[model samples]
Target: MKFLDQAKVYIRSGDGGAGSVSFRREKFIEMGGPDGGDGGRGGDVWAEAVDGLNTLIDYRYQQHFKAATGGHGMGRLRAGANASDIVLKVPAGTQIFEEDNETLVADLAKVGDRFRIARGGNGGFGNAHFKSSTNRAPRHANPGQPGEERWIWLRLKLIADAGLLGLPNAGKSTLLAAVSAAKPKIADYPFTTLHPQLGVVQVGNHSFVLADIPGLIAGAHEGHGLGTRFLGHVERCAVLLHLIDVTAEDPVAAYRVIRKELKAYSPELAAKPEVIAFNKTDLLSTEAIEDKLKDFKRRVRKTPLLVSGATTMGVPAAMKKLLEVIDASRRGDRPADAPGITTEEWRP
Candidate 1:
């Protein structure tokens, strides 16, 4: 299935059935009274979050959804059957918005979450309902109310424990592939990964979901490159893993560029706990790695880890640090101290 994070759809509820108009007649009775029954209610339109779905691609094919109309009333005081409701199944983390796309209508963040999108029109009244002592032969009835209709937008934001952030070709994808089962497209060129990718990384007895999004470049918030459109996928992450290519002309500058973009996109994202790492250390010698790590710590004002995504070097340390932050975040006791990296080698 293709990944579709956003989609626009039109929906309408079913109309109510009309009420019946009838009068009872008996051979032995001199006069008979009206006995029309009420019409059935119209069907409703609802949206529900369900399991086994991760994309909104299904909505791309079908944009219009409507509920069944209520059955009309019949003579002899018989009421029509109510129409069945229409339910829309969507993946977890799907957010529903108005046509403008900014007005949030609902956020289906977890499975079994549901919301009503539209209501069916009520059934019309029958002539028998107008009968009274003064007006025994009433002949007027009310029309059924109309159903509601509207156009809405659906946007999906992936849920993950940690998110990877870096510049293009910073080895973000390599790290994800090395530590998890996710097979992201890898290339020496830029923008090799177009969409967001997810993987589950298990370290020791603990496991957490990791998300990797397209790399960010300078001025990404101003529509530069892929822009910050994919950042939404990582908004819910507890911590951010920022990787910088040690071979880059200036690793500190690369780090700063990504930070600037994050702040420009969202303050909350920028404030998330970040673990800095120097990737592609396999290409550098031990001495060179030590020098760069010191420089990074001095300039970035935080301790940085050295890891080689291709060789799976120092990956366990990275994963461990990420899990630490994730656990702290979940308990609402986010560590106030700066993030630190462990140099000791540990196998996953």
Candidate 2:
């Protein structure tokens, strides 16, 4: 299915039923009182978070949702039937916003979360309700109330334990496919993976979801080259795995460009725990790899893990490093000064 994260839809609640105006006209009944019946209540609009869904593509085809109107009241003191409610089943991590898109109405981070978007109008009273000793024969009946209508926005954010971030052709997809069962497109060209892909990574007996999104470049925060729109999917991740191509002539520049974009998009995202690794060591010689590692360490003062996603060299160590931070975060013991994994000589 085509991936869609955002959608705009119009929803309306059902209107209340009208009351009946009838008088008791039975045989041998002298001056019978009014026998009008009350109207039934209208239906409500609700949104629920369910399982087995990851995209908002279902809302693209249908944008409007309306509840059923209540039935009208009948004679002989019969009340109208209440209308059924309309429930929108959305995926977990879906957020509901107002028409302006800034005011958050609801944020469903987990399954079974529900929110009432629109409320049905109350039912009208019958003429018999107004009948009194002085005014026994009431001639007027109350009218139904109108339903509420409004447009809203739905935004979906993927829930993952770790996110992969890098420049285009930086082996992000290769790393994901090497570690998990996700079959993302992999090629030598840039932007081969157009959309975000999710995978399940397991270490020992523990497992966590990992997300891989389109690569970033310079000016990405300003809507250039897939923009920072997909960055929202990784905002909730416990850690980010930044994979930089070790064969790049200027690996430091490539890393800096992506880091700048992350900071520009969101400071919190930039501040998240990140595990940086030099990927694709299979394409580099031992001497060249040593020189690049030395250059990176001298410039950034941090040791970067060396890995080859194609050959799966040093991949296990990288997974273990990510799991450490993920475990700390899940245990509510996240630390700001989490250390990066130490780099070792990796050969295909």
Kindly report the root-mean-square deviation of model 2 from the true structure over all alpha carbons.
9.1
On TM-score, the candidate that comes out on top is: 1
Clashing pairs in 2: none
lDDT of each: 0.88, 0.89
Clashing pairs in 1: none
Per-residue accuracy of model 2 over 8-63 as CA lDDT, tens digit each: 99999888889889898999999988888888878888888899999999999999
Q: On a 0 to 1 TM-score scale, where does candidate 1 land against the true structure?
A: 0.92
lDDT score, candidate 1: 0.88
| Predicted candidate 1 versus true structure: per-residue lDDT over 1-348, tens digit per residue | 577899999999888888877888889976688877777778888888899999999999999999988888777778888889898899888888999999978878778888888878888878788888899977666666678899999999998899999999999999999999999999999999899999999999999999999999999999999999999999889999999999887888999999999999999899999999999999988998888878888887888888999999999999999999999888885455422221122111
